[model samples]
Target: MAKHLIVGGAGFIGGNLARELVGRGSKPRIFTRASSSLVNLVDILGSLDIVYGDFLDDVALRRAVKGIDTVFHLISTTFPGTQMESSVYDIFSNLLPTIRLVEICLASGVKKIVYASSGGTIYGEPKTIPITEEHPLRPKSAYGQSKLTIENYLNFYARSTELDINVLRISNPFGFGQKLLGTQGIIAVAMGCAYYNRVLKIYGQGETVRDYLYISDVVDALIRASERSGSSIVNISSGFGHSVMEVVEAVEKISGKMIQKEFVPARHGDVKVNILSNKLAKEIYDWTTKVDFQEGLRMTWEYLINKRT
Candidate 1:
């Protein structure tokens, strides 16, 4: 019960996390799907102990948690927009595995579990400018609903069992390892479309605002949560808001080229504005973003540009 395991350590956040931990002289174990690509982990792949398995496979899940203390659960098989495609995919794929994971962790004598929750979709429409952790839990989309459900389960397990848990309601994170053309991750998608000379689509005149945090800061928070002594729920965010139009302008400024835009009607279940308050995270964990917005954008832009070469 003294080892660290990253359940979904193949993706953008997870890969970066593994690298950071390795740099800090910690040899972390990574649990990812057999199908997940290792592009983001190419540099640090040799430094990790990777175990491949499906989330629903009890045997595999149990094996992953065997002799491990803190589990960083970061797996999401479905995106926010595509969660509605299947009636039960979110429940079966995302939510159920979490509950089962807790059961397995308890059985294996694992100490703590740090879950990656969503800040963008969890609190649907904010009644205030900067939403706090105390805001009512009302998610508008299937993805958000699924995250909240997992949070509830974690709370129940924390209270009923000896297992410790921490839920990180992370804001929209954009950086080097994110999906370049994915449906989610506005900054990643925009950068991808811009590099490939594809038209960037704007929903509802680019009015939606979201809290965007850098990936390094996000990894820092995840590491902090793993070492945190208390079982609690906190928001990991930049505590600032950025609109779609503002993002577009920033990209244009960085790339020095105007991105071709096509404005479309707003999609369903989209939040109008979301700005998370990181005051709790600061107070609780003494965490804050060291990378500013413009610097983060510049780094992302450089990564995207170098990607084409």
Candidate 2:
């Protein structure tokens, strides 16, 4: 088994990745902040080596990367909807720390890095349906721009150094362990509202479309990316698009309860529609999403209902 270190191991995706690693008989080290919540990793506390610190700490980053064969970079300080208000902060905090991380990985002799990127926002509004890996990157939000910046840096290091990098431009992932209160993760937020009998908020006429994938499928893609050799970028998505209103209907259908909703004016960084083609992911990792949208909705609703009661 290969040893691994996760940069944002306490987060939704990172926590799931850590659990998956433990299930595979790999003991993984997770670097998280003191203020970060560990609710997502509560059950598997004994299975992981946890380190507490911020990603900007050079010494902690160096220590965490030592002796690790691969590093899973999943830290993101901003979201597409709110990044525009504090663009400079996103650049200084997220982009700079990631550059430093790449430098540390290069110096510490880490073999490879698997990056979790944004497929939902990276391509902006698609000029064509089913966006491919070769789609032009015209990101609208600062968060998307920052992710693109890191990708460019990874490409640079791959060309100049001996490091191998894999960028998985993952689509919208929602399932168990996601925060229900946050602005991100639409499905989780909808489930929260439905459970509490609150109004589910939808922006811009509820017509914005997104490609959703489950958390377990994303972890599988990450593991595949870690095992696969060579430097490349691929899209890990469902290749099926669902509108915002459609998601609400799915939740209503699954729970057998009506979901009360409200439509507000669209935000600045919001896109009209975004979907990714998994052709490259299939060719590279022989991977395709196993969970359909309806099944994923049922699973998420059940998890949310169980958690609430």
Candidate 3:
């Protein structure tokens, strides 16, 4: 069993990935900020080791990566919606820290670094359906640009050094424990509004198509990336598209509640269609999204209901 370190382990995907790794008895150490909430990892907290630190703190990060065989990089400071925010902040908050992380990983002799990237934002408007890994990266948002920038650095590291790097361009992920009413994850937000009788905000015609991957499937891909030795960049997605309107309807049907909608102008950087192909992941990582769309939504809804009661 290789020693594993999970950076930003308090976020949605990070939390789920931590749960899975702990269950596997790898006893992976979680590296999160001092203020990060541990609610997501509540059930398994006692069985795992947790390290609190800032992403830019050299000493804390160095301590976290020491003696770790595989480091899972899951930190991201900005969302695609924050494209209007300063690109400098995006670069400093995400890109710069990642560059520093690579240097530290190399110096510490870490075996591999699995980076979770955005599949939704990286490939702007798709010329083809089910966008493949080879699809051109034309990001419309600074958020996507920063992620692509990190990928470029990792590619450069791969060419110049012996560091093993696996970049998993993950599609829009949503499931249990996901934050509701946030700017991201329409599925979770819609369900929450339906249950709470709050208005669910819709941008543009609400027909934008996006590939949504359930949380468990995402954890599987990350685990597969860490278990494998060789380095490869792959797209992790459900290979299916879901419109924003489709998510509202799914929530209505499953939760038996109508979501009041408040249509708003679409943001500038929003893309009309962005679905990803997982063929490369299947071929290399031997992984596929096992959760059905409706089933996954149902499970998420049940979790919310159970939480409130």
Candidate 4:
């Protein structure tokens, strides 16, 4: 059994991964910011070895990686929409620290590290309907560029130092425990707005496409990536594509509330379509998404409703 260290164990995917680890009897160590909310982690706090620190702290990062066999790189300080406005902040705060962390992981003698990359933005626009891992990387957003940069560095380290690094280019993931107030997460945010009867803004015609995977499916992919012997990048996603308008309709149908909408100009760097093919993930990890779109939306809506009330 590998000694686990999760870099951002308090966020949506990170928290779910940590919970799954604890359920399997692995006492994982987690590094999180002191200001990060503990709402998602409350159930499993007793089982985790918590380290409160920022990634920019070199000493804290070194301490977090010490004696750990595998590292899960899941923290992100910037999202695609807002990253361009703060490019320098993204580079100094996110990119530089990640480079340093990789160096530390190598020095710490870590066995392998799994990087949670973004399939949603990394490919920019899709040339084919369901994008495979072989698709050309033309990330339009600063956030996607940063992720690709880290991925390239990981490849370099893996080849040069024989460090094992795996990348999961995951699509948009949504389910319970997701933060609704964030700039991203259309599903969760829509549900929250409907619950309180707030106006939900739609960009362009609201026809931009995305492949939405459930959170548990993503957690499974993370675990499988950690267990694999060889290093590889795979798309962890639902093979189906849905439009933003479709998501709005789904939320309204499930919640029995009309989601007020205002059309806004589409944001720059927003991709026209992003649908990932899970063929590689299935062939490698024998993984498939078990949750249907409507069912997953219903589950997420109920959780958001209950939490709101």
Candidate 5:
């Protein structure tokens, strides 16, 4: 049984990855902050080992990396509804911890490390549609900037130390186990609001396009990336674009309920259209997204409804 260490394993994506590992009969350890919500991880609480430690704490990180063969670095502090001016807070809280974690992983002799990068924000306002990995990274927000900074560090580590590192530039991943408050998953938030009879709000004209891949597809990409060699950086996306309004309409159709939507001015750093091309991912990892958008929406809505009862 391979031992894997997942940082920020309590969060939505991390938690789903951990569960996938467990289902595959591997030993997975979850490293989370002391105050992180456990709602997403409650079902697997008994099967996994939970270690509470701040990312900035070197000693704690050292302990977390011990005896782990693969390290999945998925922790980040930036979220929606956070004040943009407090970018410094996110850097100090997230970037520093990642640096320390890399140091620990190198010292501990970990075989491989996989990083979850932001495909949406990292490229900022894309000069080219269907952005590829080579697109110039011109991040408009501090969150995007921070993600890019970490990706640079990972590239340096791979080149300088010749370490086995893979960076998955993941697009918007939405599905089960998503939190209602975060801007990470628009579909999840919309479904939550619909379930609770709250009005859904759209920024701009709701024509903004994004590549929304389901959580299961993301997990498949990560697993394949972990085992594959060469091409350290690749995009994990659905290669299909959907408008914000389309997502809202899909959610309403799935839930069999009318969702009230309110539109407002676009927020700062919001990209008009951000969709990634998965050709490289398909060629390199031999993987392609199988979940159709409607199917994923149905699955996510079902999961949310089951969890509520």
Candidate 6:
């Protein structure tokens, strides 16, 4: 059995990935910040070895990577309203931690590294629909640019130092355990608001289309990427997109509840439409998204309902 390390494993996607690894009989060590919430990892606490560490601390990061066969780097930070305008948080906060992790991995003799990149922001306004890995990198937000920068650095390190690195540009993943206040998942937040009888605010006519993937599918792709041996960048998405209105409609249909919606001005740095092509992921890791939009919405709604009850 291989020993795997999940940085930021207390987060939404990282928690799911840790559970999946435990199910597969792999010993997964989760490194999370001391101040981070443990709600996502509460159920699996007994099964996982939890390390309280931060990526910015080089000593802690190296300690976490030591003796690990593979690493899943998923640590990132973004201010709620200032994700697009600021480069300081993206550079000093995100990029610095990533660079340190890369250095630690190189020195520690880790076999492979699976990095989580942003599929939503990296493509910017999208020059092509169902964006593939070959699309030109035109990141509009500082968040996207920072992720791309780390990705390019990974490529350079792979070429120069013979390190095995794989990047998974994940789309919007929604499901249980997702932080309702997080900006990434509109579906999760809408479902929560609808369940609690709050207004479902739709930014910009609810026409912004996104490739919504289930969290389970995202975990599946991450695990598969870690198991496979190769240095490649692949898009982890459903390869299909749904508008904000479409998602609300699906939620309404599933929960049999009417939702009050308010259409607000278009958010700054918002992409009108973005979808990622998973053909390359399919060919590379033999992975494809299995959950449809409607079904995924139902599952998420049920989870939230169960949590409330």
State the lDDT at 108 in candidate 3: 95
Q: Which candidate do you rate higher for TM-score, 1 or 2? A: 2
TM-scores, one per candidate: 0.97, 0.97, 0.98, 0.97, 0.95, 0.95
Clashing pairs in 1: none
Clash number for candidate 5: 0
lDDT of 4 by residue, 104-160 (tens): 998999989999999998998889879999999999999899889889988888888
**Candidate 1 TM-score, true structure as reference:** 0.97
Question: Candidate 5 residues 1-309, lDDT tens each?
Answer: 557898989988898998898889876899999999888777778888888898888888888889988888888877643467878898799777787788889999887899999988899888887899899999877788888888888888888884689999999999988877556578998897789888888999899899999999999888888787643899999988999999988888999998888899888878889999999999899999999888999999888888779
- Runs in model 4 lying further than 4 Å from the true structure: none
Tens-digit lDDT string for candidate 6 (217-295): 9999988988888688999999898998988888888888888888889877778889999999999999998898878
Q: Which has the better lDDT: candidate 2, or candidate 4? A: 4
Distance (Å) between predicted and true CA of 216, model 1? Answer: 0.3
Total backbone collisions, model 2: 0
**lDDT tens readout by residue for model 1, 1-309:** 258899999988888888999999888899998998998788787889899999999999988899898999999887666546663988898888889999999999999999999988899999986999999989888888888888999999999988889999999998988887777888888887777778988899898999899999999999898888869999999989999999989988888878889998887878899999999999988899999899999999998778767
Question: 27 in model 1: Cα distance from truth in Å?
Answer: 1.4
| RMSD in angstroms between candidate 2 and the native structure over all alpha carbons | 1.1
Candidate 3 residue lDDT tens string, 41-79: 888988777899999898999999999999999998888
Question: Candidate 4: global Cα-lDDT?
Answer: 0.90
Tens-place lDDT per residue, model 2, 5-111, is 99999999999999999988878999999999998788889999988888889988988988888999999888878657688888788889999999898888889
